[model samples]
Target: MATVCISGALVDKLRACAEAGFDGVEVFEPDLVSAPESPEEIRALAARLGLTLDLYQPMRDVEGVDDAEFARVLRRAEAKFRLMRRLGVDVVLCCSNVATATIDDDEVSARQLRALGDLAAEHGIRIAFEALAWGRYIDDYRRAWRVVELAAHPAVGVCLDSFHILSRGHDPAGIREIPGERIFFVQLADAPRMELDVLSWSRHHRLFPGEGSFDLVGFVGHVLHAGYAGPLSLEVFNDTFRQTDPARTAAQARRSLRHLEDAVARADPSLTGLEMLPDSAAPSGFDFVEIIAEDTSTIEHLLARAGFTSRGRHRTKPVTLWSAGRARVVLNEQHARGRTPYLAAIGFEVDDASAMSRRVAALRTPRAYRRTYDAEEELEAAVAPGGTEVFWAQAADEGEPAWVSEFEHGGPRIASPVTGIDHVSLTEPWQVIDESALFYTATFGLRTVSATDVPGPQGLVQSRVLAGPDEVVRLPLNVAPPILAERGGPAALSAHVAFSCADVRALARAAHLRGLDILPIPANYYEDLAARVDLDDDVLAELRELNLVYDRTDAGEYLHVYTATIGNVFFEFVERRGDYAGFGAGNAPVRLNAQSASSAARESGGFGRVRA
Candidate 1:
């Protein structure tokens, strides 16, 4: 935590950090200077909250200067040391001077650092020297380490920061060369790959570990391999995080630490001696997806047309379960606010549901409880950052299935066509994308793939996919374009679930027979597909008849079709042959255009019912 940092009062920041389960905090100097509390009072507050004052940071522009300037910096350092004495902190961070540096020689800088270390030793404190990426002369960690080595003082050592090392394209493999005992502290931060000045990028664009493209797992692994066992502290500086609520930001920071620990542990099993929480059980597959709507008629009709049958009704609530093949959809109408339908919950089939609950609790994520009657199967759930509930349940076995007892199956069991969920699309505003990505990766142990930009009717939408290591479950997250009220565009594209089948043509034929309103595709798409890929004439004709869009890569071919938007949600059916691993991103623009047109037609007329 950066002090005088993040959005909140000083006391509130400390309290939020403690409540969010951080073991200790690095007190930023600016925050402390502005606070009304004396050093003694703040120390007492931290003590009362069972928090450790780990570091007092940062004493800057104290090295690589003229003699007179060095003398002035020495006096300033003494004053801060006295303050740290009162605060019961033994260590202070000294960042490389980015300004006020006249000397360029490493020997001069080391001599100055040694003089400061001598002062720190007299005060019973140590200095952790750090290298900022934008420092005047010493911009690299290796350079900072060289000065620390030349200083040759007991109280002087190097502080390793991930951002400074990684943002400069410095290889972390060199970290292992530094003696473990000389590495005094470690700071971690992640950022997306951006083409900008280092100072501006570091100040505003940093994100939490899994939210960004940095390889923090490998970074931390190198640090651990070097035998530095200090607290893994987070020092993020982002415009969005600073403006958000302090408590929420603190919780997210803590989760990132836990995630980093788990990832490092998995990367290096040889580091078994290091303390870390056990990784969450890997997800087997999706169990069920629940939708909440005031009137389930439209959703039910769409599901029926997609070849799903009403398999069961919740024994205790006003919910119905629709099944197709092994896939299940729960229509939860018991507590709906309006006619607009939205995804309410996602259930995962795991090896141990209870273990997942415990893992989530350890990360300080809040649990959500739903009212249940006697003899009902209780599923453990955690609330995601986007207000979606994630339920965990064990995979069903031959002996007994939990769903059989939870729902009353009275309708005929129709032979289902769809196999399972290929992917689930989640939409969020651009600013919330990083937060949502961190939530899923930390809570569920999912790994993120590279982000791709899809051209939409409104604008270019950024999309990233998160999936398990084995690719059993996939979640494609989209950052929606800004709403264009003048152009009459919706705020976001509606969320949808895509079901996979072995033969999409057969499923489309069944859907057509059931009178489903297939989203109309323009003939231009077929001509484009024909020029792009060589497809059999019969398959092309069948796809044209079913209004399906096509995309083929070197790996495999993708065929998919979308349903008309019903309320705030929609559905898609997809078929993948060979090794097609994409979500037909090439066809996003056409789908968005068609959906927008349909929405306009529906609004021009009254919101009349559309039957399947």
Candidate 2:
């Protein structure tokens, strides 16, 4: 772990790393300088805590400068080297000159590095030269390696940072050209591809491995193939991590490395020595989704209107299970006396629950607290970064699920068109959107889809989707715009579970007849839909009457309906014709506007103030 990646005092950061199972940490220079403890005291504390002071960083702008500037660089280098000795760290990161480089020649930079290396050699310190992505020159790892080669100093070797190399679109395959022994240290960070200056991006948006768009497995493969056998240290500089809990962030960092290691091993079986975690496989489908609320009557009524029948109530807890065909919803009132109804847990049907649970443990995800009676099913669950509990249920070969027996039958089952969960849209706390994506990706092997930004009534909401293999399961994770999040977050807007059916029009009509309090679609929406797509006049009229939203593509067509918000949760019913795999994103703006309007109407005694 890198000290800069975690937020807290230096001592607290060290403790967090140790608690999170990191073998060592890269000490950022500012963190060290701001510490009240002497360097020797910090070293002693690290020893007591079982953490290696792996690398002291970073000596910057030390190369590509004039002789007078080089002399000052060497002088500064000697002082940091002495500090490293006192810190009990051998390797010091020397970043390529980004600001003070008056000379662009590699040989001049090499000569200066060699001189700095000579000064470091006296203090028994190694110089790990790294390229800053925005360096004035020597901005590429390949160029940094060339300079290291030219330096030809025993104490000098190149440092490879994933961000510096990958962010510039430099091919990592070139790493194999540099001998592994010359690669003194390795710093790993992943980042979403963004159009911004590399310096600002590096300082603000870097993520842990598996959390971003980079192909880190291939990147690390090239490094290991070159025989680099150093600690795979994390070096992220994310704005979120800098303010979040250090212990939690450190745990997340360690899990990211573990996940990356597992991915690399799986990608290349020939790397026999690399450790692997329990393999994560895509879940078959959603088993059930649990909602906790103080007033279960409102949710129960909504479910009934949507064609769901009460399957049973838990024998040992205040929980009820409702079903419509294969779709199941759990309502729990226990420990939720005063809270608004919200999604609490999701159960997935998997081929092997035990193996999935093991993978969750291996990934270091915190287990959710479940209060179970002695004879009830042992439903193992992991808490997501967004605080949703994820439970895995093994598919039974024949007969009902074993856990279903815990709920006594309430009445005869009711037949309905809703087949199963189509998808669940989660509103994430702004800070943990990236973390939530990584958690799902690493835990269930879900792959990320292209993210979309939907304009909401409050602002533009960023939506990222993750899907199971073959799209058997889909999760649309959304982050509210900053203004709305500042007010209360996307949770204040709503999270919803979407149900799939053969015909959404029929379902919506049925729901309306049953008085489901369907969300009202403005007549303007139908007019706009008519302009966007060629639909039969009668069908368009039906959609407007039933408050149904429609979206179409060359491949297929989609229709879906929504229920008015019940507390913080809502329900959506959808139908897919042909291969329409989208979530009706084109219709989201209308839906958001209607929801906002409906919320305003409810708060203002049904006479909502008009929105322009």
Candidate 3:
């Protein structure tokens, strides 16, 4: 829900929200209307505190009333609409009448709602008819939708509440059928199911999102599935939450958001690949690109085969290539770059060479080596190798080889696509996921963004990674190196995959259309998934077809996936779109099956598809 409003009574609620990293907050009417607080004062405070006034809510009883009162409420709605336009807010909360004389007359309510919605739309705002669980006429979303359908005003929409929806234990099968445009508001609140009357629970004693028993996540997923992309407010009737320190409350609110985020990700079964994306927090591209190549000559041969020409010669490290587009590749000749390379690093663009060096050093780990510029160039190098470790930084400002005389004198240049090392894969020997997580956290200040662990015949190794700023560069660290070879030789041919994707869905579609044959585990994956992440079939299937997987652990969020290609040297097409912090873990089993089948084909010299 985009327009989630917190009642103004929770004005202190802003404190709770800020602590929790909320992007905006909605202003409930009671806190503003009931109080002596002026709209000017409320607006000013929100601006001063960096909160968007998501909405002015609770314009109740506009529908199912006689002409006189209906006209009066219409005027009141106009005034609020004025305030909203001035405040740059676009939504209004209109709850169904509870205390008024309106009986369950859908026809009458529908007529009145249409008239009022037209009035509100003039002021550039929409009305959200909330089906109060205890309302005299409208209570359930299905009922509200029927009324809205007849009302049929573009600005007239529904407010889906987690409390109202889940409190009754309604199934989502019917709700998912609603179109996206009709969903104007979403309210999520949690509470222990008290023995008291439903009305009393709605009025007081509502718990925060994660603190309650109701499946708010699932409910939100349902609403999302219905195509309602609007404001989502946390409207809680909990007295305890209000009484606590506002910041703590807000932090809890943020935690609730993260909690719900993970819940939605895990709850959606359509997932396939788990990839941590790059972030803008760090100025560079990638900390390092892992290249696991055994025979040093093979490392050399592989580079030659890939059209990667050396930048004169390798220094500090062996068989490294300094390329165009501000990129560099380190061939760890220890193991012929596994069908999946180890430590394929991306070079980061840096403005302050010294400051970046200090920042990298601050992240403690196997101390990185600082490479001094040789006789040819001025840029120095530093290498940090743990998953989150800041393995290397090539100063684009003063240290690149292009600035040196050789390239300048020869009028030379590198190839197109201007190489920028996008990602790297690291392996941890410890079988424990937490231990691997600790490696990234300690070395690179990397936190576990997302993860997953599935029960397979071969078991699973939970994965984690430090998603650097905006999650633009992902350095993934694996827990329990998949047992590729028993003798600690390179982790196996099915070892790992490094991918690049212009569009992840296109990659999946490419595979599928080419008869790569994706697996179908369950049809229900979509039933509840869209409700969680708000992704469409194209994106979801692509993620699934890619075999991305994810999971939730007490330690943190995790998700990932391996591809369908052969054991070695395949790619994972990744595009860091948003806060998806993990790879697609939901697609693991599908990936395993396809991979095993592909491997079999190579041995038998014949490839076949999974029969429907």
Candidate 4:
């Protein structure tokens, strides 16, 4: 568990780790030193919390020194070993000396470590020697292991840290070569790919597993394959996590461990014998999207223009279900807030909702509950990292779903080409972008497809997509950088829903005839498109006439159209042909430019009238 060395008061960290379901903890020496409690008191607290004191960590700068300094370091090691005896910890993590280590001889280092190991053995404690990435004499795990081998002490063993090894670009496969009994401890951390120095990068930019770019599954698999049967602990030093709420950070950290374990178990069949979480449920498609607004008339009008008809009205609340083919939109006016027409909830169709809920519960995420009416369906729900509500429900077993009985459906039908949800786009703050990505990936078993930078009116928007294996449920997360308040608020680069259709041109024509406020496209876009793709003149003319944008990749072609902003939300219509897999991201700059112009025109009272 991360409680061993993470930030926060020692007691709070232990309580949080216990509550997060960690069986053991590594105790950082500083946390112990700064605590008001004595070693005996800390040990009792760990006992009460039902946590084992696995290891006391990070006795730094201990080896590769001269005779006099070595003598002094042994005295310090003796004191720590006595403390560990009282603390009920069996092992201490000795980091390679980064300072005051003049001797570069492995035999000298080994001789010094042997003496320390002798002292630890007397105190009934062990030493797990680790290599610091910035160590003066030894910075590689393999080099540290060689020194440990030379020491040949029963009380001394090598500690392998993923960050120290991977951050230095060292191959972890060599870990399999070491004898399993010699590998005493293991520490895990993931970091983004950066060009900065290792010290600063490890301290400030470390992220939880699946949140960073590191390939930790392979790293852990190698360690397990070597028959290392110890607690897989976390030793992250992230600046942001240290400053955030400790309880929330602990919960996220625990979830990351489960995610990593599941990945490793999948990669190595031999390791599947170990206890692991259930496999992620496969998502079929989106069930419905819900929006919350103060007033529903504007959203209703927009839905009408897009050829969606009111299928049912909630029996007990001011909510309505709008549908077109397999696409469903629930306009919920029960709760209103600062942003009008904000996306409130998303529902997914999974193979088994109950199994998915069980897996999510084991990760320590909170479950969401709501008041249910007499005939309403009670689907399992959970709160996501960004406070968005996620509902899981399986397809109906027979007839209509149980939830539909709560709504009354009797209205004139509107027919159009829109079929189902193509994708749902969500906006996240810069700080929580990575957290949100990890949440969806871990919860729904989604894979991040690609990330791109989009030029917005305010600044560059970082966009990434999380999609299922079959491309059924796609969520595009957009993060807008902080902009000065004077820049007319950050651009609305997110908060839009796209609907799939058989033919985008036909849907655009239908929406235009229904008086939808279509976003105007510049004629230059068509001219550029003509130069880019080889298409018939008639097709190009039709695209320009309906204000549609076109893009084609080596795999396939895409066509899409956008609607003017309605309150804080907008809509999109898309068509894919020949296995087109992207969101037509190449057309984002033009769309953003046009939307900015439209907003400016609206502010000046010069834009065309929008029907309400």
Q: Best-fitting candidate, measured by lDDT?
A: 2
Q: Rate the local accuracy (lDDT) of all candidates.
A: 0.84, 0.88, 0.55, 0.85
Ordered from best to worst TM-score, the candidate numbers read: 2, 1, 4, 3
How well does candidate 3 score on lDDT at residue 215? Answer: 74
Return the TM-score for each candidate structure. 0.93, 0.97, 0.44, 0.92
Best by TM-score: 2
Error of 4 at 289 (Å): 0.3
Ranking by lDDT: 2, 4, 1, 3
Question: Where in model 1 is the C-alpha error above 4 Å?
Answer: 269-273, 398-400, 484-491, 536-538, 606-612
List ranges where model 3 is wrong by over 4 Å.
1-12, 34-41, 269-612
Model 2: which residue pairs collide? none
- Angstrom error at residue 101, model 3: 3.2
Tell me which of candidates 2 and 4 scores higher on TM-score.
2
Candidate 1 lDDT by residue in tens digits, 1-612: 554335777788899898888888889888888899999999999999888988898889989899999999999999999999999999899999999998998999999999999999999999999999999999999999999999999999999989999999999998998888888889889999999999999999988887787899988888888888777788888998878888888888888888777778877889865546555766888888999998888889888878887967888888998888778899988878665788888888888777787788878887889997768888889887777888888887643348656778757766656998888888765656787888888878787865798877788878889998888899988877766423435424578889998788788888888778778787788888887789888878778888888888989989998887877688889999999888888899888887877788778983322223
